[model samples]
Target chain A: MRYTSFTSYDLILLAQGLGVSVALFLVTTLIGFLIGTIWAVMRFYRVPLLTPLITFLAELLKNSPVLVQLFLVFFGLPALLKINVTPVEAAVITLSGNTAAFIYVIAVAAIESIGRDQIESARVFGLSRWQILRHVVAPQAMAFAIGPLTGLLVNQLQVTSLISVIGVVDLTKIGNILNLRTLKPFIVWTVVGGLYYIAAKLIALGGARLERRLRAHTAWKGL
Target chain B: MILAPHVPFLLKGALLTAEACALALFGSLVIGLLVAALRTSSSPLLSRAAFIYVDLFRNIPFIVQLFFFFYGLPEIGIYIDAFTTGVLALSIAGGAFSSDVIRSGILAIDTGILEAAEVSGLSKPTIFRKIVMPIALRTSIRPLGSVFINLVLTSSILSTITLNELTGSAKIVASDTFRPFEVYAVLLIVYASLTYLISLAIGALHRRLNRDRMPDVA
Candidate 1:
């Protein structure tokens, strides 16, 4: 008996795929956010050598294809470094690095959005550079950056799907597998695409809510 | 174990990348222009349908759309080769993005200009072709260039559909030469350099086309 019918096991495969995707997204987002913020801070302090280098690196990362980045990490690293790397590990590293490069640019822009006069005034009031960063720049930059940061996170979530190319077995890969086995492109792809659509919408919704909350302090009050 | 001897083979892949990107660029320009017109048309139905097309394609992953065309088309008795399928997919996806850019370009036009064109009794199609398109194309050259660069990067996905484009051909050499590191590293540089050159060309084109209107553009 050839097992050609839609089986209950298919649902389990899909759930597992979604779980993989969510797990990878969360982990990469955290790592990428940290690295990107550090890069931005390196630029913020006007570190002579490192700032230019990070800018160039981030630009290179932003310009190239993410697929190429995946190849570099997943395929290139193992051969060059003489180490074993699981698909998941490669996905995490590649996605995080790519995300960080973009986030670094946004953070730099957000930091620069603050007026120099404000920093100068804060400095005159006996605020150290570190103190100004912590107490002054950080809060305002966060408020300004949150909107763009949310956009980046949503884009990064979509980007995680590219990891399926390297055999991570995310939702896209699961869709591919089910498509091949069931020979049901419409049903399999529709359900798969529908799942992705809903997830993307949820991310957008969450970002909007976060943006509203973050900007609540600046909201206009009744006279 | 080394790839020095295989430079010519890899160059062939690069040539394929160049060819596919050129063709897809032209294809996308056509789709983009049509969709942009539809989007900015007086007909609500046409505009709404165009908007939906753009939105749906933009939101979905390109790979899914690629597979849909690559696999689903054959099932429905439309037989096109992998190269054609890849080009079609890239054109469609690029069309969505380019249309967005071009639509805004059209919207940014001054109504007084359109009114003057109308006062001259120019036909709608002619006005669209002669005035609106020329202006929109000039203004949107930069965004469209980025869209085309994206199309080039996206052309990599076509490798999975069995088209031996740049990345596809690189995969073969990677396995044959057993130098995945150098191959992909080189491929990444190739793509980055390709896009950089494209953006530079776009900058020049933007300057040249808007020379008469440089004050505003600058």
Candidate 2:
């Protein structure tokens, strides 16, 4: 007998899917953040050959669809390198690289948003380059960067859904499974879309909170 | 080297992609204009309804939205092909984004001009069409271009629903040639260059249309 009804166990299945999605998003984001920042710093220091190369790579990644990039890593890389890549591993690598490319663009912009006069004055204060960056640029740039970073994070969360196309059993994939099993696309997809919507809202909320905290130093306190 | 034989097949797919994006772009512009008008209208209820539409569509993933229409429409007995469904989904999603752009453009209009039009005794629709829209659209050409470019990139997702657009055709070639790397790598560069050319064209169009304005504005 084909049991096509929605069972209570499906709730647990959804929660597990959500957990997988959230975990992957957080891990990839952290990795992307570090790699992106390093690339930005290399540009800042004018590392001779790598800066232009990094810029081109970031531009290429940003311009292309994330789905294609996922395919490249998941299918293309394994076929080319003659190695097996599990779906989850492919999702992680692709998402992280894509995220890093975007973050690098934001970081470069945030760093450039700092005025040259401030840096020159800091130099005259006899502070070393690293010290100037640490004390002077970092705080201001963080405040500037948070707004765009928040937007990027929310977008990256949605981009994570594409990994489902490649067979990772994340929330979307779970939705796909339920969608087929129950043959109820409306109910199944609505529930799945609702989960993603809530997650995106939560990330936006967290980003706003962080932005406020970062800008606290600039907020006026009335006497 | 291996991709040369498949070039004609891939071009056919790219033609389909171009057709879908072109139709969707026109559809989106119309929807965007209407939504922007509604959002900017004096009626609070209409604006609120429009706002909810934009918010819901924007917050949800495009693929989710696509599937909602793709699958749900069939259930409701609408019975459209994947191509029609993909275009409809793309237009709706693109409308949400372009509406935001157009709404901002509308908001940026100078109050003096509206007041002058009011004093000239033009009807509301006439005033909006004659004065507001032209100015808003011209100023926002650059942003609208980016949104269209995004629509192009997002068109690749239509492959999932069995529509053999550019990305879909590339997938077939990949499996057939057993060279997923070359196929996808070339596909990626093709997409990047296509968008780059579009951006350049948009820049020229913006400059041409806005030439009468201040130099900085152009």
Show where candidate 2 strays beyond 4 Å.
Answer: none
Best by TM-score: 2
Model 2 C-alpha lDDT per residue in residues B73-148, reported as the tens digit of each score: 9898899999999999999999999999999999999999999999999999999899999998998999999999
Off by over 4 Å in 1: A219-223
Per-candidate clashes come to: 0, 0
Worst 10 residues of 2 chain B by lDDT: B55-64
TM-scores for candidates 1 onward, in order: 0.95, 0.98
lDDT for A210 in candidate 2 is 95
